[model samples]
Target: MAPEPEEKDGEFVSTGSVLRQVLFGLVVAFSTLMTGFTSAWPVVLPKLQENPRSFNVTDQDVAWLVSVQGIVGMCTSLLSGHMVEYFGPRKLLLINLFPTFGLWLLMAFTSFLSVLYLCRIGLCISTYIIKSFFQAYIAELCQAKIRGAIAALPELIISVGVLVIYILANFFSYEVVTALCAVPFLPLFFLAIFLPESPYWLMRRNRTDDVKASLQRLRGQRENVNNEVKVLTRTSKVQVSAWSQIHELRKRENILPILLVLSILSLREISGQTALFSYSVYMFRQAGVEMDAFLCTVLLGCVRVVTTIIAVPALDRAGRRPFLIGSSVICGTSQLVIGFTLLMEIPGASWVPLAGLLIYVAAFGLGQAGIPWILMGELLPTPVRSIGSSIITFTYCLLMFIVNYIFFWLLANIRLGGTLCLFAFANVILVIIAYFWLPETKGRSLENLEVAFVKRKRLDQNDHDSNHEVTIELPLS
Candidate 1:
């Protein structure tokens, strides 16, 4: 077994080891940034509609454009787990970039509405796969202490991409903006060539030498990673058939984490994240803000990026549970405020909705935006991690599809305030569930987390036995 690394702030604190992790995290984050670009591409919806050369596009068309990605993502997300297992995240991510790059170009040159929708469909598939791959990739690559922050990098980069597009949409032609969106993939393809394969994945393939080599690169040469290698090697030995894997998922350990993760993701989308991301410009416009909607949307993106940046370090220090609970509280409150402000149409208070939205974005980026993805990587056991993520991502996309598809209908029928009130109510529920149910995964290794989940299930089942004791320890040398 390798000697234990020094501990600081609950993470194994080695500056050299941490620096390597951060560099790899940044390269992977570029792919995530492209997803962000695709998500916020609709910021150009108004421009596309107004351009004489572009196809005639209606509000209905915009809704379809926004919501279609979710449906497309649902189809592709199921394949992500299997694909990651087969091709490995590094190779799959590189392959995904090709379709993504070409699709961006297709959107850049084509003004036809049908072609644009097809391009969006293609991009959605690529991005969903990218999202799933990176979550699994980072989970396997980084140590437990900094895992949350590294996993959250995608969400932060996504926000940066969103902000970049919002600013660029104001200045660039739609063609130029779409063309520029392809830029990330170019560098990411080259940089990702240097990204180390997951030590865990290598272990599962019976490549102990490769696993050790991968771990050394990820952990830095001075660090001993033998103990980590042994742990993964042991995990890899427990291979199972597809039916056995399905049966394994029914166990309390697996079921509990799945339910908890799905709850977080479902609440996230139900609280209107998809609607906000896809239609912020339109949402602000419909809210009747006296301020420029595009500018307001850019400001909202800035808040998202800044708050997520602040949360990155804090994620390791303060822990996941508190951030989630706090975020839900703030998000619910902000939405409630926005709903009432719009409901009353309070004379001389046109800024309230926009202000509330900025508050919402800040709170969301601070916790909700990144935590679920972090938790997804942390909670599931390695044997079940791939398939579990696929199921979770599939459901997430399904919910996103439903939310964006009906957003305008809700706005029209319930009014914007009523619709927002519904989202606020959903957040209030999330606060309660997170407060009581979610586990604290700070500074714990992935292997330790697996044991914790199983013991947690045993404790739940044997509640009457007060004599029973369970202690989950962090990994030692």
Candidate 2:
């Protein structure tokens, strides 16, 4: 086997090359446009409430509109990695975008709950494709050191898109909102028309010249393209099937990382993140904040956008494990305090919960919100990355559904504080697990991670061999 490439003193690629940066920016913009619907949903809640009778939709029915999106999103997420691997990111992304854009346009005309649900499912599938492909695409493009930073651009743009939609929806009609959603696809359609396929994808296919040309165009370094292509080609092995790749992972020490990714994602969902967003108005109303609940939710969206902006530069600098551990601590504490405030029936307790909730959002934005997706893409080897990422996404979506379902049920039965407390405890557990098990992947190359696992497994095998030899010698007597 060829020796693995070592990180050289100056070989650390930066996202500074103008053309590459422009491409990266375009990709991020596409992600933001794709994600605009998420924040827009909160903004449109009031509109849905205003004409609930016209649509014959109940609060529970509207919630399903959101919930069904989450359901289909999870399903697509679990499957998307394989789709990306099989079909390639460029093709899958382009194919997914048309339906996604079409769904938004269709949603503008739909008053029927069934049609709305179908549109949401289509949106979910598109979002899933976008999320998986975008992450994998960035991962394949950037070097290890700046992977977190590059990966973070999508999340940052997502925040900006949310803020923009929140502002627009505040002033615009539902039709305008639908049009704004469609507008993102127009630019993305043009960009996809010219965008090169991922070099790593080409490498996987053994098209070395195509990989080299792609890297040359994407990185703006014609000479270095061959070197990078050589590195990727050296390690590239074709898997016959997605299931076969997943089975290979099962035979490796991939369990801990998989568990950690799932736990991080589960904690993110179950911690009432979406519940707070979905029911922000109701929570504030109960607290007697006396503000327009829709406005409050929009304000909340603004806060999230601002905090995520702050997180962008800090994420790569602070390292992953610290952010994960620290955020969990903050999230847990905030949830507990908010729960207690609600439970105590303190005067102006609504402010307390609101403040805690904002802090929780900030903490999440700083850490789990963006980090899990980055880590999910980074932790696995190239061969199984698509399958592994999909699995993680699948688990995340399933947990999200369970959490949202339980949250709604609990909100009615136990009230707000009790519901939040459940998430608080879950966050506490996540903190402990993350502290103990999650290794810092900051600045570590993907190849190094693979070697580390391989070496560890070899050491374990040697230990087992020694033990067996000792047992045999003693038994001979």
Candidate 3:
């Protein structure tokens, strides 16, 4: 489609203005910051558990606190996608932030646990919506050459947010930490009000002039963006209502990409990032590491931040499939060894789980954490991207909800080592799926990828036996 959008020397070529593109990406990254806040309770909870007025909570209660956000996020993610269609992406961000800003302010004025839960749920809605928003916005706006790097930016910022929470938790009490988290949302809320709406979305609405203006601003005045704008105009918009998105998946046009994305997204959760970091202190404590839990967690947070920074460039050149398979193997091994050690109660190597957890988090940051979302943005078409993303994101939260809700029970029933062993097995299976089924999206424009996959889907329908067509060939690097 579109003759593969001219590349230079076999590399993906991007033409957007650097300053405007980076600025837009930086501003939207705030969404991930709040999402990180939604999940950072573990780092702050060691102190919360000790405070008498903070309500008597057990390990199970803390787990519920981390998971209930997913419950709320799962319910609202699809609705947020439709809201993006009805009001546009910029407005969606503003609407999403209101509850978080208001709730956190109220929580600061009171120490009630119930209020804290309400605040967490409120931000989770924003968190999931923002998660959906970034995928849609970048899918619609980014140049192919930089897409992998740009897509990783939000997750990178999310790691930074977790790091900030960890650093703050080192000194602040529960109430003060909650208040500090709320402060950033104030500036972010105002920034969302002023950011440009997705240009592709405007094209769908047939707002020609606004589309041109947005393109000019995004691509720079002197640079030519007419061909790109015209390309966006030709893409289809979803005609079906949001409730009927499932029915769309049955069509030959939608089935393969949707299945591939759902598999990756679901596997991403089961990869254990949430189970490891959101509850890192608990897991580390179970390992019987002599080091203080908070200190160890802070180190984990720093590792997450550093490794994510390293992954941005890697995803672009090394491509998605290699990192997904390579990182999965490493993460699986670490989880398996850590699980074995803890299950056996190996004496004196309390360092085993911590060492494994560090490696797991680092490898996770390198690939599993960032690449799937990039592919999610790449594979889906503009026509149904909102609903497609909603379905994908809803599955993300729902799977994460299951992981968090059952995490402690899994620990209690199977013991720490056994729970980790389960994750390890799941990751091992993921590597096989990724190699045989996942496609390489590096060096391709969103339009080119959509056309090629759609073409392949049509061909499979005709041949019915071209099974070899299921997986793609990546560049031999």
Name the candidate that leads on TM-score: 1
Tens digit of lDDT per residue, candidate 1, span 1-477? 112222222335598998998888778877888778878898787787787474687988887787777887888877787787778777888888877777888888886888988888888888889887687788788877677778778888888888889889889887889899987787778888899998877776678899999989998998988767766765554433344457778776666777778888899889997787667877888888989886787788888999999998898888888898899899999989989888888888778889899999999999999898888888877777777888899999999888877887998898889999999999998887776667677776776566555542344433321133333322211
Please, what is the TM-score per model?
0.89, 0.86, 0.87
Worst 10 residues of 1 by lDDT: 1-10
Off by over 4 Å in 2: 1-22, 45-60, 110-115, 288-292, 347-350, 455-477
Pairs of residues clashing in candidate 1: 2-227
Backbone clashes, each candidate? 1, 0, 0
Report, for every candidate in turn, its global Cα lDDT versus the true structure.
0.79, 0.68, 0.74
What shift in Å separates residue 212 of candidate 2 from its native position after superposition?
A: 1.7
- What is the overall TM-score of model 2 with all chains considered together? 0.86
Q: For residues 1-477, write the lDDT of model 2, one tens digit per residue.
A: 112223321354654554474565456446545765754554665676675634765777766667776678777876787788778887777787756667877777676768877776777777777776577677666666666677776777777777787787778776667666776776676677666787767877777788877777767763355555655765556653777787777644455456667678777777777677766877777656666776777777777778778877787777777887898899889988988888888885556866787788888788867877777767666777777777777877787677767765787898888887888998888887676656666666554444333423223333321121111000100
Residue 191 Cα positional deviation in candidate 2, in Å, after optimal superposition = 0.8
